[model samples]
Target: MKIERVKSRVSLRRTIESGTEEQRRAVLEIISTVRARGDEALKSYTEKFDGVRLDSLRVTNEEIEAAYQNVSEEALRIIREAAENIRDYHERQKRESWIIAKEDGTMLGQKITPLDAVGLYVPGGTAAYPSSVLMNVIPAQVAGVKRIVITSPPNKNGTLPAGVLVAASELGVKEIYKVGGAQAIAALAYGTETIRPVDKIFGPGNIYVALAKREVFGQVAIDMIAGPSEIVVLADETANVNEIAADLLSQAEHDERASAILVTPSMKLALAVASEVKKQLETLPRKAIAVSALENYGAIYVTETLAEAVEVVNELAPEHLEVMTAEPMQLLGQIRHAGAIFLGRFSSEPVGDYFAGPNHVLPTNGTARFSSGLSVDEFVKKSSIIFYSEPALQRNAGKIAAFARLEGLEAHARAVEERFKK
Candidate 1:
């Protein structure tokens, strides 16, 4: 594994910036071509990249029906249960507009409303995540979004993943489309003849999908310009190295580019974790991917104190942060930035990713410093509302007029001044 000691900020920032300009430009061209050509462009790219020909981009009712039977009842049941938990979590996050009455009869409030429509992109790759579908769709539904459409690449046989289809159907989202990659993102942003343009797009994908989201950002709202998955475990001597190793590898198996790092004050724990990671790597089904990820991006940095370790973690702003110290809560208040902070030994990353109910679509690549994970806030818009009675306006008119005049806008001052005319 590529282990490095905690050094300089400049080197750390350079290491985190992974993708190249060439990769970004290639994605931009793909997005532009799809935007210009529409459905015809979609068919060509679907065949060329996904190796599947589609009669229609839309997934029909019959296809969804077939998906239910194809998936095992146990898997379907688990999807339904996870969907319930996700729905429950997001429902609590829903907010309503509120107004406040002033003593002078002035009414000030906010109006909250959901977007008209939203698009969800589910990755179609080596494995399908029904959980991602649940996480992305439920929050929008809870926010009262009227229309929720989903797009995913089709299998070589031109069928959507059964678990993904089942999850979407359970969420009452029927506008499923058979499109993927940058083309899918372009179609959602520009509005092809078949796939209508949405107000915002949510969900995660590969580098192509990430760059496509960045390109179409202004055209449509995006959840975030996500990067590869990353996890940082902040542990102390009391923390179990085996549990730490399992949690780190859990994220590393996501992809070869995924990063898994451990920051602790104990050198003994560091070496123990390294050994456990090696032992667990042999048994993991995705050992090749996990091994490559650990070999390239994984590391352990030992700090002299837990306080110093937390400071380094705040600077890193990892996507998933687990504080596995003896007193996890003691360090919670010190964490200023993290996509999701998992405290205590049992509170693992997968807990939040699967059934813990928080939206798993978190900001990656240090965006957590400014942005946040997907929630009802992402799907809803807030508008401030203010109303002042005639008497109230009159009482405050002179002050308003004076302020507007001081700002050098005579018309603005006169407008309020005229309202006071007997």
Candidate 2:
């Protein structure tokens, strides 16, 4: 990894904004074609991209049952345990509709309603990640989303991965399709003849999928425009360099575009972490991808103080932040922007990525400054409810009418005025 002295905030911003321009255009073209041709476009793209031919898009019940058999009872139990934890965490986040009344006979409340349906896109690039299925679908289910449809690429045999199927079944998501890529996103946004359109789409995929979600934002609500996975470690001299380097590599193994960084007050500690990363990389199977990512996007910066470290961290706004300092909580309040914060050496990135309660689908590429990780909030809508008695209208209608008329909206003013006509 490159070692850069802390100089300016823009350095990290410039490094993170290194995605290809082609990712934008290609995703747009795919969205336009899918909008025009619908299911035909989806079929053609699936064949051309995923190398799978399908007579029908939806997976059958027999296939799901067979997937259960493919997985052992022990593996099924483990997935169930993880699903229960995910469901418990999200269930706590479920909000109820509420109302408040005033002495003037006025009532105002916020109504929380779940979407009619939602679509989840499970990635099928290098490997099948059933954990993503659990992370996404469980939240939607907790929020009372009626129909949870799923889309994933098929294997060469035109079948979904056994683990993916098992995860979907565990979540009670039966409306799944053997489709993936930007085409799957388009199918969810515009609706193929076989696949119905969804009110919102969730889950993570490659750049093509990210750009596709961006293109279809207005058509359907998305979790966020996620970029490559990232992790930032803020360590002190007392922290273990080997553990920190291993944690950084865990995220770097995701893809070549993924980022991993280390910020330490001690230059010696920074160098130790860098050296440890090299030593650990030799044993990891995805070392090539991790090495490329660390070379291009990763960095080890030596800050003068822990306060200075947090200042640089807020600027980096990494997707995952780890505080492996002498006292992790001492710096916790100082952290302003991070999708998820891991404290101490024991709390590594993959713990949250796979088994932990928090959602791993985080805001990437400095988006943590504005956006947030996926949760029940993404699947539910809040509507403000207002009620007023005749006396309340008499008190406030003139002010409302005057305000509306000042905006040159005569009709809006007249509507409020007519409510209190003498």
Q: Give the TM-score (vs. native) of candidate 1.
A: 0.93
Candidate 2 displacement at residue 336 in angstroms: 0.6
- Model 1's C-alpha root-mean-square deviation from the true structure amounts to 2.2
Model 1 agreement with the true structure over 5-50: per-residue lDDT tens digits: 5632311222434358998887888888887888999999999999
* Stretches > 4 Å off in candidate 1: 2-36
State the local distance difference test value for candidate 1: 0.87
The ten-residue window of minimal lDDT in model 1 covers 7-16
Clashing pairs in 2: none
Please, what is the TM-score per model?
0.93, 0.94
Note the Cα lDDT for every prediction shown. 0.87, 0.87
